[model samples]
Target: MSIEANLEKIERLTSKVWRSYSKEDPLGHLSFNEYDYLKAIQAARVPIRLTDLAKELEVTKPSATNMVKRLERKGLVLRVSCSEDARSKRVMLTEKARAPLESESEIYTIIAQKLKVHLSEQEFDALNTLLTKALR
Candidate 1:
């Protein structure tokens, strides 16, 4: 297959996998925007400033603040005053966020296990290497 054709196939497969996997998340009960915000906080290795999150999410400061407040109410995230900057606040994932994150991870693991039926170990390794390079 041509490179373009392979890329198209990968895109299609990824979409299908995500759609199917997301159905299993109770968090799917939340709006897509809310889920996205929560996922971003969970993915961040460290607490992130509200302004930084706004920039990362391409949202306004008020919008980011509102979303963080909602997440805090849901017990998925906590907003704390930044120690380094008195006026700024940072968002961190709460223990409540772990269940949903772990559930999502399990879904991905299941999808990967199913895909392994079609891909050999070497093919999977090559695909991982290529994807990492392409992402860079």
Candidate 2:
């Protein structure tokens, strides 16, 4: 009933929603760190530097490098020399990662559709706006 109580409830529900979304994908069996790396590469669209990936994931450089290496070995990602900086390497998603990303997107679409069954269009729009504002 109180503002704090409402906020807490929202946070809990949002976390559950995210977990549900994550689990819905058969290909999302990847660890959270791996999924984060894949998502970042998908979003970057360009060769992303290891330092930048580390910063984006809020992890250390060595941790990012290790993760990239794992993805590279799995054939999900490739490490390429940065054109702008000869000494630096960039991570790029390989075609192997694309199918998994697409599967995750489909999972989210199904989750969204299920949620829409419970929420009115206006309520969903307001929730989206609130989440965008919170991120900012």
Candidate 3:
């Protein structure tokens, strides 16, 4: 196979692997965007404003609000008033979200173990470095 074909195959496999995690989502019908927002909020460890979420994702504020609303309905996140500014709302993950987040992580660990069968340790490290560089 040509290098181009190999690269395309990698792209497909990467998307497939990432997309596979959501199928077992316990949050009912969380979309990829919602999962991303939840992941961002969980990673932040600080209360993040809806506007900030929008900015961080390079999306519109209304879009972020909509995503938050959906997550709110699912009981995965809550919109709390900012302590310093009551008028603004910050998003935070609820305890309910912890299970699904942990589950997704466990699934990734399993995926990594499966991937290890096909790549050497050095090759895996190189792949990670190259993928990060490509994103940048």
Candidate 4:
């Protein structure tokens, strides 16, 4: 197949895989974007400034602010004045948010197992390596 044809095939399959998990309620309380932001906040290890979060997510400052507001309303995240610069605000995940974030790891493990069903061990490992490299 031509490269274009192969790429289109990969896109279609990727869409299908995303759809398989997109509508599920593994995270019943939070939308995917909210959960994603929470995951990012947790991974940061330190409270992150709103501007930095926007940069990390490649979103506008206003967009990131809106998302953080929504998360605050849901009690999943907290925004506090930056200690170093009191005028600026930082965002962090709450203890309550950790439970759902932990659940996501389990959910992904299940998803990974299902995805691997069609491939042999070698094929699965190769796919993992190739996709990781491509992402980088």
Best by TM-score: 1
Please give me the total number of clashing residue pairs in predicted model 2: 0
Comparing 1 and 2 on TM-score, the stronger one:
1
lDDT of 4 by residue, 23-117 (tens): 65445666768877887898898999999999988889999999999989878889999989988999988877877666566546655686699
Backbone collision count in every prediction?
0, 0, 0, 0
Model 4: residue 114 alpha-carbon error in angstroms: 2.1
What lDDT tens digits, residue by residue, belong to model 2 across residues 16-132? 666876665544567977988999888887889999999998999999999999989888999999989999999998887877686666556665676678899999888789879
Candidate 3 per-residue C-alpha lDDT over 26-111 given as tens digits, one digit per residue, 9 for 90 to 100: 76476778889999898878889988889988999999999899989988999999998888999999989967776777666766
lDDT, residue 87, model 4? 82
- What is candidate 1's TM-score against the reference? 0.78
TM-score of 3: 0.75
Q: Residue 48 deviation, candidate 1, in Å?
A: 1.2
Q: Can you list the residue pairs that collide in candidate 3?
A: none
Off by over 4 Å in 3: 1-24
Cα deviation at 2, candidate 3, in Å, is 6.2
Per-prediction TM-score:
0.78, 0.77, 0.75, 0.71
lDDT of 3 at 36: 91
Q: Give the per-residue lDDT of model 1 (tens digit) for 38-132.
A: 87787777999999999989999999999999988888888999999999999998877768776777666765676678899999888778879
